[model samples]
Target: MRNHGLVAFVITTAVLVPAAAHYLSAGHDQVVKFATATTSTLELAGAKIEARLEHPLVDPGESLRIKLVASSAVGKRLDVGLLVYGSKGDEDDRVPSPPVGVAHKTVSIAIDAEGNGSIEIAIPLAGAVENRYSPSPFTSYEVLVMAPRAATKLDRLRRNSALIGEGEGIPEYNASASKFMNLYSWRHDLQGEDATLFGEGVVARLDAHTRTINPAIAIETPSTTEVGKVFAVAVTVKNASRKPARGLVLDVETPIGVVDGAEGIEALVMPDNATFDLDAGESRRFQFRVMPDQVGVLGLYARVTCNGDDCDDDSALTKSGTFDATEIVKAQVVDEAPSIVGRK
Candidate 1:
């Protein structure tokens, strides 16, 4: 079956990472110095609240630190609670598996008689072993800060998935946060202490580094080809991990009505579903010759995965987790059978 999700991801990445070559060419030091952290601010009941990540990217098996600061016009101690949840970088927090993974921490800022204070908290990140399964190389987290009373309610809602059934929290918090953010609107839904304690809150995002290995895939094809003539297409898979990638299955999908029937061309080509092994830092290139009978555009899609069902458990090859690579190639098919110039 064709994976439209993979196709969409491939298309979007191609358009978004046009400058990736330049970015990757930089030195390690230059890459490490790149700034990637963000900060957010909100206002509630004459108090200015700010939230930011102390370090946006945490190594695996470490903790993510976030710093929160608030300046209140009212000279009294303010209690604000922060609820944080995480998911794979590509996945949305609305549906977090094993719902208990959510992190909840409450911190109080002592607003002095002058009303100015800030505090920071460290949230422990889950490792592959801790999660009891292999995880993606990157994980993203969302942080929501609200008054202790409102935060407690939201935390319960988030943990139990009560507000929006099971495995969904985005919509519930989105609605609640929107209502609680506005001074005039907070009273409509929230009661006395809850409404009064609730102040302006801020939302923030943080990304954690879980792994270092990153495999890559590339597809090449001519822009135009003859309808009846066999044309060349190439697919390359590279393993960037320190260990070899075993049980690697590469699946290529062609437009309807076209077959891998290379009449006379001679080159190594991958079948519809080809399984192969790639060593560390090595790349494998597979070629294909396609002949189209109609004159129009043809699209070729390719997807590769490691440690899938096709791979056995010999224990020789590293079965760390599943790695995927997807790409699309389009070529215009032209009919070259007409001899109009000579006939005329």
Candidate 2:
């Protein structure tokens, strides 16, 4: 693991062996060429604003920072927030407000008389993903600056823009101001032991084979159970690989009314993830108690991660089990036999 308060940088762009956990200090982007790197941008007449992340490739263990720069013939500013999304379209967690979801960090930028200025924001990796139990790797997040565009009188007021808006006071407003939006993305993967770099256009990827330990899990008992009944189910975790998996974790997702004992083995309650370790060719069974409230079949999911940190790939978080479950039939009482006897 990298120390939480150390300062580091990537000196080269060669293929790097992913490192363990580490931390980085501020002012990490010692060398940044803004205008040269941004091949795309959204700009207003005589002014252009672009947002760029310090590094295109980042370590999952460290925080992600973005620099918003603006240059123009005149001095102007915009209220802005960030939007981060996943490659698989994981949009549950985002920053700022809609269209970016709910986040509280909104900043304003002011350019100098020379028409150049910069403002930045740092997104801590700890809670970057809202409602996520733990972070996942091989996952790329798109970061963009979301600013309110001056579409209408109300929009310009809320956006706090100097630009004019229709129906407010000006006859024609600059609609382009409301439309200025650009997106940039980078991978959250591991790099050399102490540092992670955000390499523009290059994503550091780790496959399952990179992990020394091969792990698997399956339902070993109680393939079927009755609804509204308390039952015990077992899932055996196996290390199919020949090497030991350090800081291993089991990420299990099951429907409601069903619970697992896997909650603690050193666990983080949110997202329902667990952490542990396994040796070469080792197998262990974990028991979970289930109580199905409604009738019908329920689904089960499980995966083994060497630990879903920047150092490991979020492999096999797939459909591991789809066991069957049944519900008890309700019974109804019959009327007294007197009516039936008289009819007979």
Which candidate has the highest lDDT of all? 1
Return the top candidate by TM-score. 1
Per-residue CA lDDT of candidate 2, range 1-344, in tens? 11113223322221211223121211212111100122234453345667665344333435556677767736566555444433322234332221222123557777677887778776643223321333322233445444333122223222432244434554332443333211122323424521122223222121110001123664433434454454444455766766666776554444222112211111111223446666778766554444444443343334565643432453332212222222222233477766544553
CA lDDT of every candidate: 0.48, 0.38
In the range 125-181, model 1's lDDT, one tens digit per residue, is 663221224333234455666655556765554444323443443434344333322
TM-score (all chains, Cα) for each model: 0.43, 0.31
Error of 1 at 254 (Å): 27
Count of clashes, each model: 1, 9
Kindly report which residue pairs in candidate 2 clash with one another: 2-21, 2-22, 55-198, 56-198, 57-197, 57-198, 57-199, 149-178, 150-178
TM-score of 1: 0.43
